[model samples]
Target: MTTTLHVAIDSKTKKAVVFPLVFSGVILLLMMIFGVVMLLGQGKLIELNPNMFYKIMTIHGTGMIGVSALAGSCIIWYFLKQYVPLNTAVFRLNVYLFLVGVAMVLVGIFAYDFAGAWTFLYPLPAQSGGMWGKTGAALYLGGMLVIGTGFLILLLEAARAIIKQYGSLATSLGWPQILGKEKGFGPPPTVVASTMVCIVDIIALITGAALLSMSLINVFVPSFTIDPLLAKNLTYAFGHVFANSIIYMGVIVVYELLPRYTGRPWKSNKIFLIAWNMSTLFTLIVYPHHLLMDFVMPKWMIVMGQVLSYMNGLPVLVVTAFGALMIVYRSGIKWDVASSFLYLSMFGWVIGVVPAIIDATIVINHVMHNTKWVPGHFHIYMGLGACAMILGFMYYLTRLEGGRIDNKLDYLTLWLYILAFLGLTGSFLFSGKSSAPRRWAEHLPEWIPADMVAAFFGTFVTITFLLFLVRFISYSSNIGSKINQSDDIRPSTHG
Candidate 1:
């Protein structure tokens, strides 16, 4: 007797998958350019109107986060195609909801001239002008809600696929079932569906519901009072976890790509899997660290936040760094630009995680909570780590699409981009130590010589990034015919 396994692929799903990845790369490149411009102006390295800075910031936040969400959903959608055939109806629903949702967000942000940052904190919205602002906010929320419902449907489909493949969700949940009853019959460890994506999606949906509730309350019952503390907690909870979800997606890329490069069989190492799972578990409860500066939050909660923050770093550091290290050390690693970026991404994570861990300390939080140090820590993590990984993946995918390795010019451009980011973000951190404030149009007396030095670095960094932007545009336009067509364009699987 023979058993057949089926996988689905079609033009619509293919387009849905590829469009978001390419769109995100283009958007991120632009965001970095804008960020460099903004920093240059603020540091007095360049002269620009104050309004431009806010506008760039608004665009940067919205564009980057929008891409992050699209990328996350795209990954889920793509992977689901491998196991279960997504119904045409569901696929159409997914695309429509996502596009509409993104449109609403853009309209809302533009409506308010949304300079208040993506955080969209309360009282600021109330202070903004006109019905357009309110409509924009509603549209943004509506879009997300619709996209979220689509995710719910996707999750159910994934769950069904898992059950069909492995008997039930319970069996799929643990190691034994994944290991299988017979040799060569069991799914690979990574092949078994993990709950991380679903869990994160659920949390996002819950947070979105709360945000919607807050928006409705503000609109209809203008006199309705909200506890500032509660509002702050919910907002940070959503923001923090939502940001981390992108990092988790990066983790997914690492898992999928690393072993291929090493030429080793992808092992279902239980410890590595556990570490990934642990990181997710700890991350959900750690958002309160953002609120550590609040005096009103309970002392126990504060302590718990700090503890969770510290603990969370361990699993990420171990699983990502150590896992990559082990793979690289033992394998005949190749040194293409894509792999080079992947290695550098690990360093970026290390740099950001250390400072973030430090900031989680109560003593350190007292000093750095509202300072430039905050951006310093996150820029390395989000801007460099997450964004770098995305770029690496983009290079790999672009190579696949174009049927060749990216040209030498593209490689040179990528290195230049990396150098500029490090210089710009590193200077931002140094300025923070000397008490330079973030998001300010002008510096006060407290700004010292260190700030001046940082400004100089910022100027050079901006120039480097500007050059990078030009190069990227050139590369995108001329992704020529396949150069080396036979090589596996997907990430290496040496393990």
Candidate 2:
């Protein structure tokens, strides 16, 4: 727990993280509102036209994933800087690019009525019927490309710095430890995790950018076309990898903070190194599971997808969850908002993986993959798992820098957030079990009950997040105040 950092984070670098967190919190609440609105429309409680509903859906999916990733990057930057000599300018650039991309996406959706879902699956952008045109598709796809470029650059920098400091990426991932050459503790868990994320996300983002660029060009030049099957492959490969990577980045918070609160060391041993390496491989290859419904996707890929999907996140999840329990078992660790949320995040990951695995089965994928089941598993996974890490880090920061103490309302909101999220995800899973179709703007009378139930709970989830956001914003000023009034990134620093 007393692991001292070689590089000290100046006040300015701290703000780079603090600002992104607050922004992410604000976006979380906003996106949740859009979620509830979609549910209300499906439940027939609100008069949402199909166009408006789809627009909201596109933004909701895109915004939640984007904001969560932004928040996750904050966790990575905050702790990772302690180990590596990072150029804060690159980090700051990511946030800037995210904001600009978000603005363009907003205009594309609301102004131009871009109704293509976040999947942006190839030909769909070029063929939006009369709902949207080339301009809207360009804006949305271009926005995504811009965001992906920034993240890719940030990751490239991380990969470079890791190589510079540790001699190689393999060394940083503790290959020596995993191969039984070095028998002691490996690099810090943060380094190992960051290295894995860098490798996977860099590949994921580049693949996505290629697809996005082709999609954008196809929009302007209708004669240019891509094979739909190939497009779907690119879609899930990029979407699944990029989206899942948020949790990988978010988990850095868990690894860093758990041991700190428990007053124990979270060592990276051979088992831990092996688990991470396994996770990286599986995470990259498991996207094929998402395409099991496509019969044309070759037999071997289908078999491999189903097999790896079951193993995808299990390795690191098991180690982290078990390590957490062992470290805190009877350590008399003090309970607070941060600690509570950290533990809750683990519960989220564990519970979320079960249904995800269930859906990954070849048979179940045929039945449930296109239904609300997919959303049910991922919501809990992202909501309680990844988002909790960001929220925990928020509380963790408040306590560390602002000396913020919990009020009764904090506990009340925590209970409301967890229970409400459970209620919402439960309704989603139930809807899937009943064969309710997902991504539909309107629901049949039979599905309305579940839709309404989800809407009811979704409202609370959004409201509780609003409270959480407000709380974090209240202390944004004191979050490690080494303020350099100039937050600008100088071009010279780019080199």
Which of the numbered candidates is closest to the native, going by highest lDDT? 2
lDDT per residue (tens digit) for residues 1-495 in model 1: 111111134545545555556555556666766766766566566786765576567667756776766665555555456555556466556656767766766666665454656666664444455423556556655655666666566655665666677676444444452344433323443333245555655676577567757755675567865776777777777778767776665655555556556554445455555555566677778888988888899988888899989987577567668778887785766666666767778888888888899889989888887788888888888767877667665554444433445567667766766775677677778777877777766665456454455555545545544543343333443232333333543334332
lDDT of 1: 0.62
Which regions of candidate 2 fall more than 4 Å away from where they truly are? Answer: 1-8, 482-495
Per-residue alpha-carbon lDDT of model 2 for 1-495, expressed as tens digits? 333211257666777788888888888888999999999999999999999999999999999999899888888888888888889999989989998999999999999889899999879898887889888999999999988988998889989999999999999999998888878999999999999999999989988999999899899898988888988988888899999999999899888877766667799988999999999999999999978988989989999999999899999999999998997777767678877899999999999999999999999889998899889999999999998898898987776665567789998999899999999999999999999989999889999999999999999998899988888898778766733222111122111
User: Model 2, residue 371: what's the lDDT?
Assistant: 95
lDDT of 2 at 403: 56
Q: Which stretches of candidate 1 lie over 4 Å from their true place?
A: 1-14, 45-52, 83-96, 127-194, 445-484, 488-495
Q: Could you tell me how far off, in angstroms, the CA of residue 69 lies in candidate 1 after the best superposition?
A: 3.0
- Clashes in predicted model 2: 1
Deviation from native of the Cα of residue 363 in model 2, angstroms: 0.6
